[model samples]
Target: MKTDPERFILENTSVLSPPHVPEIRLHLASEVHDLWLKTEEDLEEIGLPPPFWAFAWAGGQGLARYILDHPETVEGKRVLDFASGSGLVAIAAAKAGAVEVLAADIDPWARTAVRLNAALNDADLAFTDDDLIGRSVDFDVVLAGDVFYDSDFARALVEWFVNLAESGCLVLVGDPGRSYRPTAHLDPLATYEVPVTRALEDSEVKKTTVWKFRQ
Candidate 1:
């Protein structure tokens, strides 16, 4: 790794609130400190992943809004935020009074980002860098935001989320019409026209949906 995760994140991002969920603030990349301009080759050269943690995605913003608006969804429950980019949803769960909140992401940079964000929000959260796919879920609720972008990951995640739902855990996901989201396995809960950066998405507003995993 060419740059330290903590140092890079601290230097490259500014704290800001996402458009859809302004109640929570996150460290996000802006035009002044853009990570999006960096190509995959540049990232590979630096031993970094795609830097997904550097922005507030539409799906995550919608999910965080839902959780904040409906505190009962997480209050006193054990919750896991899977693929927790920027720790937005996980911090929301923690603020909503979840007894325990775990933010899991495979990237070391993501782990560093989540930790710092949690600290910034004064929220208690646990973090794991291990890939938790196919593992038994210990939490009462599982939340995933914008995790269906990758085909391979979406396939594995769908099966695991279904199994978790069947096992009596309440599983929820937020997605913005990703190609791999398993519609057959989801029950629609709410939809939001989430505002996002055009630099990252095709439009400035994305129609994102929150769904419950059907058992």
Candidate 2:
């Protein structure tokens, strides 16, 4: 990568906790408007992705809250946190006693952010950049937060999530009514009024739902 992600993140962000889940702290951009635009232009120049890791999104906050509140959901299980921006959900799983936790995202910048955030919370987690959408994997629980925004991507994930659920792996997701989220296969586990950055979302508070995927 052309840009030094760790140095940039450290220099630009603040140590803070998400509103709904305060137990874990992350490096976040306090003033997202300027930082968000700056990162967009900088990353565009360097051919890197936008920094989704710079904020604790609503879906992630809700999912992390659920995992911390219901520790038994992930206790003693091998877990996967897919699209793990900043590793928030993965860290919560680790705190909840998951035997092993793997956080996966395609962004290289997210890799650095996850590592730094994990250290802040003293949580042990492994990370991968591999695209595991259609691939079968061994895991007791799979966690996804704030996905399903795009039509094509959500289409692919639905099939993969269904396969995991049908194969007896517990699949869970947190969503804030994204346009493409499939509600038919989801069993609502919990609901949360999660605080979010107004710059990134239309509302300051999002009505988020944590759902268990079922066959």
Candidate 3:
């Protein structure tokens, strides 16, 4: 099939908006425990309006930025970035020298974005679709970001993390303290004041926290 013009434009562009220029120079990794890829222009072309409209969560972006600054966390480890939005976390893991990285998301657009961004950054990532649901894989670390906005989804995701952790995978999550964050199973690891443009359906400027699975 012929590629869509918007997708084509996003694939070829470097910078998307003026504010995004800084992010363009910075690499992003998945905060979710799956495969994710990121591109600067994915949000606009996907029809998401500003802020959340850009690709990925500021929390995820922040975490990726952090990992880039501190590569020891992922170097030589096998990693997974689940619910990989713009695949920022996955990209970060790859850049940080993870031996293997996978970015996973339910959204098809997200998967495409991950592939494009990985190519843009010259990073290698494994991408998976819903076919991997209910399946488990061995990974040293798993990351997630901004995934607790909805109660039901948060609960389910947390449960999955708990299972992963029990299986010996280290799990990490970056949350903006959304209403649905599961307080019981998570322990705060670090906190960040992420600068954000309004991209989500609600609110702007999210202050996020990074947490590790406790149980």
Candidate 4:
């Protein structure tokens, strides 16, 4: 990393609440356009991946809202927030009375962002960078948000999620109607009109859905 992730995030973002889930606040990039452009420029310069962690994506916002509204789903359970960008879902799970919560993402910057955001909310969350796909999961609930954007990755995720669901782990996914979502394997749970930056998404508001993975 060229610069300190914590310092860079603090400098580039502001502590703001996602519109869909105002109860939870996160450190997100304030100027979406500028940050996005800079992220593209920094792709090779600083080896930074896409700045997905720098925003409160619609899928995560909807999922966080769902978890907060339906606390019983995660209460007293060990939860895993897979591909947890910004740790929004993980924080919500912790705040909703989950016995333990783990936020896992492949990007190290995302882990840093999650740590900073968790501190801002005073939520205790464990973080991991390992790709746990096709591996045994010990958690009682598994949550993923906006992970089906890519076909190959989505295919892999669906397989792993199916295994977890079959093993009695409650799996939930929040998506804004991405093309790669495995709708056949999901049961609709909830939906929300999530506010988003036009610079990042096609529209200012996205119709996001929370789906429970079915075995």
Candidate 5:
């Protein structure tokens, strides 16, 4: 903990809404925020984490949209938002009527960001900085967004998700076609043209899809 996460996030982000999921608000790094421009080296020098929690990613936006639209997916069930940056998807689960929501991420900064964003939306949720990729949990629904960027990480997550799905927990993911996303054991549920900043994505709008993990 080199940086004071709460202070750093407050100074570097603005309260804003992800375009596709405008019903929920978050503390995000906008174009005017230097966080949107800082390179990894710059962030390291400033004692900041990668700051994934500072932006609303396209995959998160699409997943949040789907959850908000299809309340039955989470309503009255315990939900887990894995790799939850900024707690956007977790908040959506709460808003959609989940009885309990847990946002899990390994980044310490993300914990603070999730706290702030959840408070902004008055969405009650819990957060854990533990890496839950290989562990079993007590949630009824599992939602992940934009996690399949690297081959090794993707492989680990896919395996864990498959196990969770087979155990009868509803597993869902929002992906923007990352290179290593699973090619099997998944069923597409919904898709959206998620609006995003070019700084974070290849294009201003990403064609994102929500998929359900199946046995």
Candidate 6:
């Protein structure tokens, strides 16, 4: 069955709430799309804490904005959007002229969202929910956005990314100053002041940084 992207967003919108609900508007190439994220009141209705989908992080938004600004980074490159949520980064890569873009996530809902968003933008993306453990693929670049919230997961992901970088694949991480960000073997590439709603607990606005893994 085909996934309804708008319905998925609507159903998951109440999972977590931010302090202020902002209508996020982003352009996929010449096409523009908008979605209203949940506010704190919405979380109360769903009975869940913040970071419900890890979709509200500023890092993803920053990465999407970066792709829109610098199309050359993805042009002609084979890209992978790791832990893709809402598929924003994957869509941006595809719109920016990536030869091949894959959106990989453990959550089935996230993969569904990727397919839906790709269709909405009139782009094609490879979606997968395969376990990445001990799996390796050669690609020009791997893009990760806001995947450092949890310590265990962050450690595992960083180790995996570092291994990929060592094998000559460029890995970029878009982080919102998460505590679990690895300090070593990482080089800061760019920083952006992302306008973020307080979706996570006690966070107001996040000034995210984009770092490249140094081999």
Per-residue accuracy of model 2 over 14-128 as CA lDDT, tens digit each: 9999999989999999887677666766576644444778889888999999999999999999999999998999999999999999999997688999999999999999999
lDDT of 5 by residue, 40-140 (tens): 43345555444788888888999999999999999999999999999999999999999999999987578989999999999999999988988999999
Which residue pairs clash in candidate 2? none
Candidate 1 backbone collisions, by pair: none
- Across 93-198, the per-residue lDDT of candidate 1 in tens digits comes to 9999999999999875789899889888999999998889999979999999999988998999999999999999999899999999999999998999999988
* Overall local distance difference test of candidate 3: 0.66
lDDT for predicted candidate 5 compared with the true structure: 0.88
**Model 3: per-residue lDDT, tens digit, 17-76?**
212124333223212111112322433343432222235576686667666666788899
Using all chains and alpha carbons, the TM-scores for the candidates as numbered come to 0.93, 0.95, 0.76, 0.95, 0.93, 0.77
Stretches of candidate 1 above 4 Å error? Answer: 32-49
Considering lDDT, which of the candidate structures 1 and 6 is the better prediction for this target?
Answer: 1
Model 1, CA-based lDDT? 0.88
Best by lDDT: 2
lDDT of 6 at 178: 85
The stretch of ten residues in a row with the least summed lDDT in candidate 1 is: 32-41
Q: Score candidate 2 by lDDT.
A: 0.92
For residue 180, model 5's alpha carbon misses the true position, in angstroms, by: 0.7
**Tens-place lDDT digits, model 6, residues 143-212:** 9888888899888987888899999988888888888989686898778777565434355567778888
Q: What is the lDDT of residue 33 in candidate 4?
A: 69
TM-score of 4: 0.95
- Model 4 lDDT tens row, 132-161: 999998999999999999999999999999
- List the lowest-lDDT window of 10 residues for candidate 3: 28-37
